[model samples]
Target chain A: MNLVLLPEQTDSTIWQINDARQVSHLKQHLDVKIGDQIKVGVLNQARYLAEVVEIQSNQMIVTPVEQQAIPNKLPVTLILALPRPKVLRRLIMDSVTLGVEKIVLLHSYRVDKSYWQTPFLEQLDHYIQLGLEQAGDVIAPSILLEKRFKPFVEDRLSVWNHSQTTFVAHPYTTDVMPINFNQQCQLMIGPEGGFIPYEIDLLKENGCHIHHVGNRILRTETAVSNILGRLFCA
Target chain B: MNLVLLPEQTDSTIWQINDARQVSHLKQHLDVKIGDQIKVGVLNQARYLAEVVEIQSNQMIVTPVEQQAIPNKLPVTLILALPRPKVLRRLIMDSVTLGVEKIVLLHSYRVDKSYWQTPFLEQLDHYIQLGLEQAGDVIAPSILLEKRFKPFVEDRLSVWNHSQTTFVAHPYTTDVMPINFNQQCQLMIGPEGGFIPYEIDLLKENGCHIHHVGNRILRTETAVSNILGRLFCA
Candidate 1:
């Protein structure tokens, strides 16, 4: 974790840490001691320098020293096909670390229905919390679950964020993504087996430009990070 | 697995499959039947369309139908600091799937010396084979191990492949990678904790221009795929 992100404390001057993971990390990895200064940030807020005021086996306290500038999140909304439960955990964390603004998990032809039934989807907050902790960012990206592809693409996508350039990653497309294409991007990626031709046509009709990322086939997790990195990680 | 890669057959027209994993994948995933055509590639050679000539419980035979086009590998070379054992296995597979031409696992100040003792390093061919199956490519990138950083940078790196544009990913550098930068790139990435100031200085002195992805710190696996995607995915 790059920054220690905590929930908004009632007293802005000092923050208390109670989570065991955070406490252990502080003690073991950081070797944090009283009067030690550490980089800290509040959830969905600005970063700051905080000095350790108190330390104990179960709790620690820190007081804000100075405000620090917060970097802007990438202006990209990701449309991803839901992956298996194991991959989803890492995917959420990796996406958050990449600083994506929003994510939509869409149902697709190849996506297993059992994946949607996983308990992980029901308690998304826990997963998002893990991602937030890994990224050291307080703000969580809003996640939308779309179980119906046709309605979502035909009825809703047209009315959604069209200001951003829309793209759907397809293997057959000869056109490569333009370098440093600076614009708010809405990227759609398919599941492991990829979208069928009919689904590709539906996405195309909705104003998505198809782009290819070389010939080698990538797993969904790798593809998501790779696409985001290619599009926005300048 | 996209393409079933096999050793070169002296008969030049027929190939036999013996691996249980490959047989099961073909039968269950591809649902391949006798006379069915499948994409096949020879190790480090050309791709071809092959027809299943015979099938049994444990063995199968395929005959070449015609030669197929093989996609070009990405022209980038990667220099990575050693990661932990588990991450290293996945890292090698992910890098190969992303089409990197060469990899150098260099020792650094932040790298745990114990990581060098992993048994997986000795069985690297197995991991590379898995990556080939995932990407449907046959050629494996040559991996070089540099246990000493100072001598590797001062004595070896200077005489090595300097033709490619050299860049190291650093957090403090404000310079973003150039857009549409078309070149055979040599990218250097640090370990989980990142390169210390002294190591960064040595890299700079050896002609590595520093670049930053963004403000958010990324884990080593995420950083590898993200950096590759940013550099050559287009």
Candidate 2:
């Protein structure tokens, strides 16, 4: 973890960290000690230099010392086809680390029905928090689950987020992705086997520009990171 | 697996897959049946549409039906700092799937010494093969291990691969990476805490450009995919 992100803590209050996972992580991985200055950020707020003030078998305390500049999150909403159960946690954490402000896990024809049943779906917040910690950012991207693709694409996703342009990643497309794109947008990436022709057609009909990075087909997680990096240069 | 990669076979020869792993995968995951068409590729050769000629309890036979186009590999050599043991496998697989033609797992100050002791290092071929299957390509990229950072940087890496420009990833750098860079290059991505200042200076002295995607810090795998996508737009 790059940063220790705590719930919104005001100055002058003792910030206690009692969660078993975090406490163990701090003790073992970070090896925190008293008077050690650690980097921290408030949720959706500013960063600060915090000193480890207290440590016990069950908890630790940190006091914010000085404010630090927070890196801005990239203004992209990742619309991903829910991936395999095993890759779900890492993908979510990576997306958060990449600074995506929002994510939409939608159903596709190529996506396996069993994938939606994975218990990992319920632990999205855990992955998101880990991602935030890795990125040293405090804000958590809101996740939206869309089980009905047609209705959501036609009635909601197409019309929502007017300020952000929608971009869909398709490796076979002739339209190469734009470079130095300085605008907010939503990007749709397909599942493992990729979106069937009909699904791609629907996405196109819903006003999303079909874009290709190059000739190579990338895995869903790879495509997400690649497109985000290419579009936002982040 | 998008393609089943096999050893070089002549038109008249019967290609047999008797390996337990491949046979099990074909029988279970692929559900390949007799007379079913499957995508297959030759090692470092052409791709083909093949027909399942035989499906025994323990082995499978496929015959090449027609020749197909093979996607071009990206002309980039990735220089990555040794990552954690668990991540090593996925990183190698992902790098190959992303089309990196060469990889150099180099030592860095931040890299844990024990990471080099992982048994996964010996199983690199397995991950590479898996990546090839995923990408539907057969050519395996050569992986070079650089255990000594200083001498390798000064003696070999700086002089080797003159055809490829060296681009090092440094998030703290003031120089934003160039957009629309159309060149074959080698990208050096740092490990978890990133390359130390001394290492960055040494890299600069050895004619490496310190580049940043953005202000945010990204994990090694994310950086690898992001850099490959941005540099080659792939």
Candidate 3:
């Protein structure tokens, strides 16, 4: 909430920007004023210090200076089973903040049918923007959806076949947790109840090694974050 | 809820023990009968299929059939800033279920003073049991408390200064997201408002490399889970 985001910067030397929402937010909420400097992150650009150039009726103009590069992202790509719409929204933002390069949301047997119809799918940009605004990063990860699991596994998995490692996280099964992984990898996580035995078998048959994060059953969102943290820290 | 944990067996044919609390939980909550078959994990022993042998008014007896090894835990150790009591309780349970070998709850600037007086610390064993029951693991992770950040960083941190990589996750840094981590590692996470610059500087000086998940700010719990997942996957 401390960082301000602008949609587009005006080219005029004395850039005049209308910020009704921000004005109400700043004057009434944050109690900001004309000469104060605020952190601003431009869409797809580095963050910068912005001086409040002018304040008018529901509008505020800011002058940007000294651009700073946003931090780099994690190298891995994450492919997750689509969770409930409510959970999916939070997960999308979480993943973005964690620096995942790409995300693929696939359907699974345990996924609720109603979740696929969520209006959030239509406004993917909004979700990504929320993440960018929070972390002050301008780059958005690529997001894709797979309505069916089998075909995607059969057709698209080949791309990951040559990958140094591919891990499929499940609650059961005994596979050594990976350590010090220095190569490009792909991680596949299942739905809430986890991948059905058949799904697990199929993934195992396809070269994805089954790994467990311990014995505790984690909710979809918790599992995603836990797996990511472990993978990167290693 | 699915798997029940039993104390170490004594002699060749009998399980040593009286756990009044567990006995009561099984009777009142799970509605266990004299002959119900239950999944049981021995402390440090493999999970075994056990059949109820006897049920007394205040005691239950079971015999093991087959031994099964529990899955491996996450490869990294988590050093978290103590969150509020409720969140801390949840974190303790979650960390256990997720299979972390150790958890260090330390003091940070943002940690509320009232949190230090929580009853959760007095009942740590109860939280550990909940995690073990869920994950079916017998060994509990070692828990430690550090009241002052500087002293601990200067004195005790050397023990964690092994070959394993150490990372301090911060939101504003420009460093590339970590990837393909090594086998053993240490991760430091900040509190809600995050680590102040001085604290971050102190940690950096103490041999921790600063890193970021991405651009979105995540709650402490979410950050822990995400980093664990990424580290395991990597």
Candidate ranking (DockQ, best to worst):
1, 2, 3
Worst 10 residues of 1 chain B by lDDT: B176-185
Over A8-91, each residue of candidate 2 has an lDDT whose tens digit, in order, gives 766554687777877888899888899998887777787888888999998889888998887788878888888999989989
What TM-score does chain B of candidate 3 reach? 0.87
Query: Model 1, range A164-224, lDDT digits (tens) per residue?
Result: 5678888888888655564688888898889999998888888778888878788887887
Q: Is model 1 an incorrect, acceptable, medium or high docking prediction?
A: medium
Q: What tier of docking accuracy does candidate 3 attain?
A: acceptable
Give the TM-score (vs. native) of candidate 3: 0.69
Report chain B TM per candidate: 0.94, 0.94, 0.87
Instruction: Report the poorest 10 consecutive residues by lDDT, candidate 2 chain A.
Output: A5-14
TM-score of chain A of each: 0.94, 0.93, 0.87
What is the lDDT, from 0 to 100, of the residue A90 in candidate 1? 82
TM-score rank order: 1, 2, 3
DockQ of each: 0.71, 0.66, 0.34
| Worst ten in a row by lDDT for model 3 chain B | B9-18
Residue-level lDDT tens digits of model 2 in B1-234 = 888877777665578877688788888877888999888877777788989999889988888899887777887888999999898988999999988899999999999999999999999988898888888788889999999899988997778545557889898878988766767788899998899999999988887889888767788888888877677763
Clashes of each: 0, 0, 38
Worst 10 residues of 1 chain A by lDDT: A156-165
lDDT by residue (tens digit), candidate 3, A156-226? 77557666567888868888556545357887888866889988887877778899866567766677777
Q: Give the number of the best model, judged by lDDT.
A: 2
Estimated TM-score for each candidate: 0.95, 0.94, 0.69
Taking the tens digit of each residue's C-alpha lDDT, what string does model 1 give over B123-168? 7877777777788788878999999999988887765546556778
